[model samples]
Target: MDEVLFRGSRKLEIMQVQAQLVASKTKEVFATYSQATKALISQAIHSNQVEQLKQNIAQLIGYVLEVTRDFKYQVTNILEPRRLWIFFSTVLGGKWSRREVGIACISFVIGGAVGLGVGLIIRRRETIYRYMEAIQISHYLGPEGATVVEDAHAPYECGQHDVLVEVKASSVQIIDAQICCGYGRTFRRILRRIYKQSSSDLPVILGRDCTGVITDLGKSVKRLEIGDEVWVTVPFWSQGTLCQTVLVSEARVARKPKNVGFEGACSIPYAGSLALSALTEANIDFSNAKDKRFLIQDGCTPVGCVLIQLLNNWRARVTTTCYKRALPVAKALGATDIITIDDSHYVRDVHEKDPQEIREGDQKLLLKELEVRGETFDVIVLTRNDCVDLSGFCTKNGRILCTAPEELLSDSCGFFSRLLLTGYVKLKIVIQNTLGLPSDTFDEAHLCHATLDRLTEMVEDGVLQTVVEKVYHPKDIEVALNHVQSPHSIGSTVVTFR
Candidate 1:
């Protein structure tokens, strides 16, 4: 009986040992999975998969430490700050190279080892929040003129307003502020004052229109919650539109169209919505404007293209001006009547011709010459600030939609009056994208969906093209800006962030 009992006990011990082995093997498998995830995340980051890298970095690192080894201390507490600073300088300083990463790592280890070690010993969490660095424009009524300056961006708190939007990417473009029928410079000055008075605590966010997954929800937010990918636009007063983070009212949030990437969709809202608003302000009624003649100045520009596309959608007659070099591109985007204004002979002939000849093109002459002949159109859309003299030539009682300012406002009263006063020649603002606007003041999401959708469609359908004659990386910002300011350039200038 004693020998039999010993054998049975031995069998039970053996089975217990086997169960332990299985558990150990399972953990090893999990550790391997964690390592794979880390490798993938590193690869994604290197590849500039910004959104995916953001999502996976934290969880993968956490899993690796927990399962691979019995790490008693927090690695992040030791490494996070040091790693973050190095990571940031590397990322924001310029495009990432293997050598740069190596240098950053070496410097971090040499300089921040003690701090990182202490942090690791004290920290329990190993995750860091991802944020994009952005440029904030602060305008002050300058001693010389309206001085626009850039400030370091911070975070924004969403008050009880209702909606919040995460920005994917923001489009940065320059417009002729004097002629553009918007209050960008004026509002910028106001924001500068508020920021100055607030001790520079104000957050700078970008993305006039955004398409992203919703990561959090507010208490009053009934329609959205965690994990809902949404597109949001803030109201005009919110300063969160130009940075990596954005907070908006619920009234401004909307669903993103699934077909487009977030980056591609960013400009849509600002460009598309502005067009809609401009049309609304004009009161020409898109549904009734079929077969009517409309003149769109500066057809080579994005806004001009947007205006042209919308008018064409309504099947209106469209006339546009393009430099001879840009004529092909403009035609490709659907310019029916194109006037090449760079030719001196063309200009002189039109100036000398009979007003009637200028009014109606004889097939040999351009439409601008016809305009000199006192030819009037159903709608005249001015896009370039310097394209035409606003003080002259607009037909009395003819509808005029302008995106740029013809002259600088001498004072606030004149500025406000021009914006408020309505006349025989109606002035309307048409913008498709909104960037660098305060979110606290305007509804951003509604504008994004309403405008961005149309803008994307125009691009995809070949109605709009990014005449990106040049691409300047983030580090080349100064060079790009200077180049753009030069007297002559055939195409539009753009800066891209990598």
Candidate 2:
């Protein structure tokens, strides 16, 4: 009996060793399979084979779900707890002890955990790739002044009255250059503090207008829809349009005219808005402009050209002043009388005069020349700073409109001095209104959706035409900005995404 017991015990020990060997071999096989699978997945992802990776992952998830479903059905319907334990033991050759059973259970748990972790990692990677990355040209205060940043994580969530636009084209204006050089820092800092509650306002984008497709719309937006192409003029104190995308209030956007492309459409918004505001403030509309005489100073400018065309469409007689090189452009825009100026002086006929004399005589000479021809304008639009007081050239009840009011504020003056100057301007306007002076500053026009809508009609009707001097890619943004700062810029400098 002792020898039989010894033989049986030895047989049981050998069976245990064999089971251990089988488990080790199974674990090694699974480990090799997992490593190979991970290698293939990594290669697919790195190679940007997104579709193939997605298909592999999908198949893996489906197989896991089908296996889980079959296991659940068997456990719930065909096996009790005791039978399940027996089934696992039978599957392991029915020679497993309590220790071996525990080991098998642990292996199953670890395998499920590994599978779950892999699925989570793959799902996370897919989630990360789903979002569209944004890029922008941002200005900073330090040595890294302006930079083009990829994956800019600026907040683009739309508000109740806002729209998100995918910018196709934008134009560089004088304001963009000035802001890049730190213009309006103090005022914009105050505004930023109020809005964002942060002290620093350095990293701001610098663009005024753009043409783009609306990618998203706020709940309160009524007239616009996603995918509609539109033109926008961003508010001065807000984030600008020199980026892949921008968020603006619906009130500042209008449908782009069908007659123009993105580059042409972008060139129109800022200048067209200014021209319309100036004309509307001066009470000059299509209804009453027929046969009226108007004069535009520095008529080769973008805003000046827009003004000339709009007035011409109203059947008004347009007199314009420009440098000799810009005369053809001004005339082609429908200026009835083109007064050529020297490159440095406002009057070409006074070019031979002394610097001081030219400064003093150009205005007088031009006015005398106009008077000698019995020419007095019903409206005098000052688009640039001139030594000449064009107020004297308007008819008795004519209006004087200065479109560039910020130029007055740009002079070197203290806060109190500027306040007093502003008061003096108001007093002058009141006096002109009271005494019937020929020159009168128009009230500031509030830019809104209605104004842009009107401008769009004018554009489509062939009344207002876009003048794009040059179109630069975003890669050449610095060149575009520098070009706009040139005093000799004839029209608009546009930057296109494509």
Candidate 3:
């Protein structure tokens, strides 16, 4: 009876050992499975459909690593000799359970097969998912060249799709007024609130003034395709224009200019539009300007210089203000009258007489008195400076055009009073180029490319010339800006990109 009791105790111990062995083997199998899962996911990440693998497999690595660490400690501390003796007794005598090993093996095989099937099903679902890689341009605000805010992904207009354009070189106008006048902070606050309100499924891209070839195109797109060279304009708020690749509207594009390379063409989509608008307002008839008078205040500005030549070829009397530095070129461009405005009335009286004179004996003073006595001209155009008293300078019933950033008569009490009380003038805006107009609306017209091909012919024949002074590379934009802002700048400054 004592021997039987000892055998029974030994058998019970063997059964405990078998249970521990099964637990250890199960942990080893799980560790192997976890490693296989990691290897499979790593392979998938390297494929082209990497973006489609949105499953947080990296997170799984952390969880599995923790489980593996705990299991390893348990397995290392296992009492193996005692476990073996207990297993021997249980297998040989107690349950007659060698047949059950096949059952356990089959269960593990089925579980592994099921896991693989589910993994394959998940991978198949991911295969069809697509995502956008966007480029964004934002202000370099932080020390690491970060922005306070950036335009991530904005949704497409539902079924409305758009053509994506990637830029090579671009510049965004930063009105310092917006940043300095509290408007920027207020705007940023509003943007943060809006961002909080937004959902996270939005797409994101970044880019700035840049040019690049189209590397890919969506099935819905038609106007452009892969391998097309395009120019992209980035707005102040980064939306993908600064990105390595950007999307643009098909309508916003023109065929890349034949003469200018991609580097030069990139700027024209934005600044060229500004230049075109200014010239359009000058209203020089390409066919008939050869006999009219058109005056430019600072004839050397990009817009002003372009307008000068456009007016010159139109046969309009081209009058521009030039000091000693710019006089020679201004005259060479056919400036009918080049007035070097000074305190002396001597130079101005030589052609139009001293129109700005304050004394009766002075021509300017006399002109002022004549204007008061009801005198005017067919057209009066003002381009620079706010010192000109536009309300007081007009002739009765004459057309006036001005480009001073100051508020109009309605915003000034004295100026408003004159316009309201004096009933002599009937004002009509022939054309005013404000920020509202599209940039390219007047390019072909100003260049007279189609409307008056004769003007293009004249330009080609050296009868007309565009006044370009200096060209700077993209990196030297600050240098170009300095020259443009210089009081002594003579002609138009162009920053060429390579």
Candidate 4:
């Protein structure tokens, strides 16, 4: 009975071992199937994601191309000049009768002509209006001579060598005031007659120089074009620049200095030209100016200031005489020495002497003072006739020049008188030369386009500066002229158009 029980136990144990082996194989197969199924599902999902990403990239590229095409199309439409032609072709594609086509062409021609005529008329009227509203002097009435005319005749059309400038800003100079008071009337009248101009050319403009835009160009213009900014110096015999527009010879126009505005630039041309001419007359030039000594009388004047600055630029020593009030201006303009004029005692205390004698005495005293100091200059610039006797202050082989030589010739009335006076003046100059008093007269011909261009370079390089003390509008031109004529006026007085 024990053996049989043991056998049954063994059989039961073997069956249990077989059942356990089968269950292990089944679990292994199911796990392998699950892993393969998971890998396939992951690969399928990755492939679908890659395909979707490629489609999205394609769509993005298409969108960029569409934007580019749209931008190009818009630009082409805007830049195309044939758009009107294309529209006309599309609208008038159908055939029409010969009479209808002729009528259409006639209508177009008439419309264009009318439009052109209206535009020309408007332009002409505007130009006329601007010219009529200019600041002009009908007669020599001093500072109050300048008047704004609303019904004056327009200036003549541009000559072959002329350009029309729309004045932006102009300077009211002492010379302008002097001209208003008939300073150069006789000479200018002579010039007009020589040029065969009408004697009835009244209402003369008074500004000598201006900064402006070129509004019109003559057929012969070469160096300048319309809308170019220019600095212009009008001849004394021509119509001046205080007007809204001025007709200037191309020879008198130069590109304005880039460093300055219209107002600042306006202060330069006349003053710079005058100073340069005076220096040239004195035989002083850029090459020999270094370390040279100069003496400028009435240094508070515009020409005097320019002389000081220009000499300073050339590394020269400059001595100036001015009123006490103008001392600072001289110093700022780089004068090496300043002598203040005290005319109070001479004007007030010398009641017994003649006024002219008193003035001469005062000037002599100044010369004596300089002599006492043993001070001499290589060049002496005499701005006023009162100092014409200052030749003694010049060093050996030095020179004296008059900035306003016209004033010396002003006393003569007729052509013969002027001619004889000029001879006398020449004789006087020769006598002075014999006396070792070297002197020369300033010639306006030296103030030309070349001089202006050189000055523009100096100004742009900061070697020269504009000195404007006051600025006024066109309506206040009278005040500006008065200020320029005032004894206390410093630097330049500018009149702006806008």
Candidate 5:
């Protein structure tokens, strides 16, 4: 699939290059032809009888129109459907569609547009996707270099199925560091090559989450139109949303939830994708989990917060372990029980699974917090994959949903060895059931689209809330990244790109 998109992009680039060459040559030829034709026709009008001169000029007009029609059909065959659509729309306006019906009088529209030098400038093809103001990072930021330059990257082009958004605001995420510096080391070398330091390459765009107004649309795009306000989490490899204007694929975008403002919408993409994917893919029957114990670790983090809100909406018996500060919001989101992470000693009690689970409780130490009288959690959610081991978290055959890929690795490797040592415990990280591996398989669009749909419902119900800590300007991206990395981060940190 990657290979196919790469080839398609290459093909598009090649046709564009060829079009420029052809348009340039056509202008040169037309200049000479026009000069010579005008000179000869003028002499005939002055020297010959009016009837004869009119006859000669009429023949030249027929020849010119015939040639232009032939060339247009032949050359456009090489152009893709999207480009051809753009070309005709921009150069001919509504006349292209009217061409067949009004074939007899084609010269006024087609010829007039060409005579004004419209066809001679193919670079205008970029008007659909081009933007003047965007955030750009020319090179990877070192451990200390966390700078983002706003007011850069102008006149970008929208490709096929791409939508041009006049960004009202965009937000930052923890992954911005990985994007700015191309800093990541995974088991696979594939991603490292793209994200690694670059000596001579186009600057990488930053910011993935945004809410913006759609000012323009590519020829092939139908899902959205100009004047629509949408929220999107663009693909990391594509252009970043942290710019004055961004060209994004329609598939990765969705209608902004009306309940949230741009500031809140900007923080939903990655975190929401992870949380919702964790719940659905983990195969939890949210409706049926009202009586089951569901443990969510790190409720202080953004992903955990979203999970708690969603699980609570399902009336699931949710128990979260977070810092003392996060307990309020977690509880407000319908967490039936809360446990603090700062306690030295926790009271762990064993209990039998209850059909009617306990509903709500004050914050308690992990050891003192008895989720139930007997059985362990039916589902354990690790917001971050910091679990040293998974043995104590779940009952036998209990499902574990973790956001970390490393946990999946540890779960897979030394499986037999660990099973013998720790006894039998079946644990599965959250997205593994759906994604198989963190990124081993390809997802069609933003993995969060379904989540976004559900988010709309939750927001309308006045139950789901976007956790916001601080909103920063694009120039202060470094501050936002620092906040997200800091233990002091109150909730989600956002960078507003107004």
Candidate 6:
């Protein structure tokens, strides 16, 4: 059992396996409660077998403890401010080999004596509640913009509307990577320190989505309770989910359905809520959805996929466009029809196929193609901001929505001047950027709990699913981000803290 467990762990580390692959290892299924009774009956006649099983489990736990302890702390003297400062410098300076060598020497001499005396004494009394006090982070040194501190300052406090959670899994998202690599880094640094209305302090961690068990509840949190397993999209800059524990708002929290594993739950909250908000704001008539024709320009995008499923559940006649590789997924997600795009010469193909039909200068050629085919959609969702003349296909009274910014669509000199012309051409076009004008931007989390409740029912009813393509450790966050950021990504990449 010891050898097998280590082999499995090593294989997982090498393969970067997803949650489903790990779940497949447990094949013994018991369909009824009587199975437990039968197992107990067998145990009555098999005391030796039960004892052997107990021994195996104990040995496995011991091995796991040693392995986890070794990796959990590189420098355990976290309380000593001076050593922490030097240790952090070495980490940021790329002197990890030297840091490990120093750790080995110190751990051998000072830790050796202490390990023999206090290790056994402490291990017997330790609990998961105590784990909350550690406030561990894999990276602590940074002039590079996002590395955080290691100490009890993390696993942050629960606020009036928050719930304290021991995060089982968190995920790397594109926005998170953008922030880490210094998208408005200096301005954010200044704002966080001096701004009166900012949410949290400087270096307030980074993970965006997570699944965990509620360890503590806030004063105003009525919807959740301690020990409830939930998923949350941690609101911006207050407290991140990268640590062992996180404090999330009740409004941003949702009960994770039994069908959703921790790894998969990490991916659902942020994208799901955003898509839900878009669809909700669209105000589609679900009772007559089949009569409502909708088109999603990029069906394989994260939010696009969720929208497809939601539209399907609403019985909408949904048409989607995607690369040839995504045909199967698009169909499985309930697209009524799919238009496959050839990446090699997408623009050229559209032009060559219809050079004389629509002679306007670089109009939304895609929409023109649909117009030539006499296909009009009531709702058209643009995943990318492009030079697309949506007026050609959108019904006059219907809606054309751009998920991206208007500035992205124009390449020529007259973009700003042409705004009125463009608006008049497609009178009902909606830019999501202005959805909640007069506010900073759309606050999707405001509708998070409501959206997730509906999504949870869909998941439990087997109508929707989470796509977790890869899983990683917190130490490999950059690698995980790269995977999800790639154009080939079909699903989300998650990071496990447990």
Best by TM-score: 4
**On residues 189-269, what C-alpha lDDT tens digit does candidate 4 reach at each position?**
644554445463365787889999998888998988999899988666667888777877788899999879999888789
- Would you list the clashing residue pairs of candidate 4? none
Model 6 score (lDDT): 0.65
**Candidate 2 structure, TM-score to reference:** 0.60
Error of 6 at 288 (Å): 4.2
lDDT, residue 207, model 5:
73
Any runs in candidate 2 off by more than 4 Å, and if so which? Answer: 1-147, 195-199, 342-374, 405-445
Which residue ranges in model 5 land beyond 4 Å of their true spot?
1-139, 180-202, 343-375, 404-450
TM per candidate comes to 0.50, 0.60, 0.42, 0.63, 0.58, 0.55
Worst 10 residues of 1 by lDDT: 423-432
Predictions in order: lDDT: 0.54, 0.75, 0.46, 0.78, 0.64, 0.65
lDDT-sorted candidate list, best first: 4, 2, 6, 5, 1, 3
Q: Summarize candidate 2's per-residue lDDT along 392-450 as a digit string, tens digits.
A: 77899998887653542423466776557556655776687699874333222344667
Clashes of each: 55, 0, 44, 0, 18, 1
Segments of candidate 3 deviating more than 4 angstroms? 1-247, 261-272, 275-290, 332-334, 341-387, 390-480, 490-498
RMSD (Å) per prediction: 28.6, 22.6, 25.1, 22.0, 27.3, 31.5
lDDT of 1 at 416: 56
What TM-score would candidate 1 get against the native? Answer: 0.50
lDDT of 5 by residue, 145-187 (tens): 5555544555345677777778877766656655555532121
Per-residue lDDT, model 5, residue 285, is: 52
- Candidate number achieving the greatest lDDT relative to the actual structure: 4
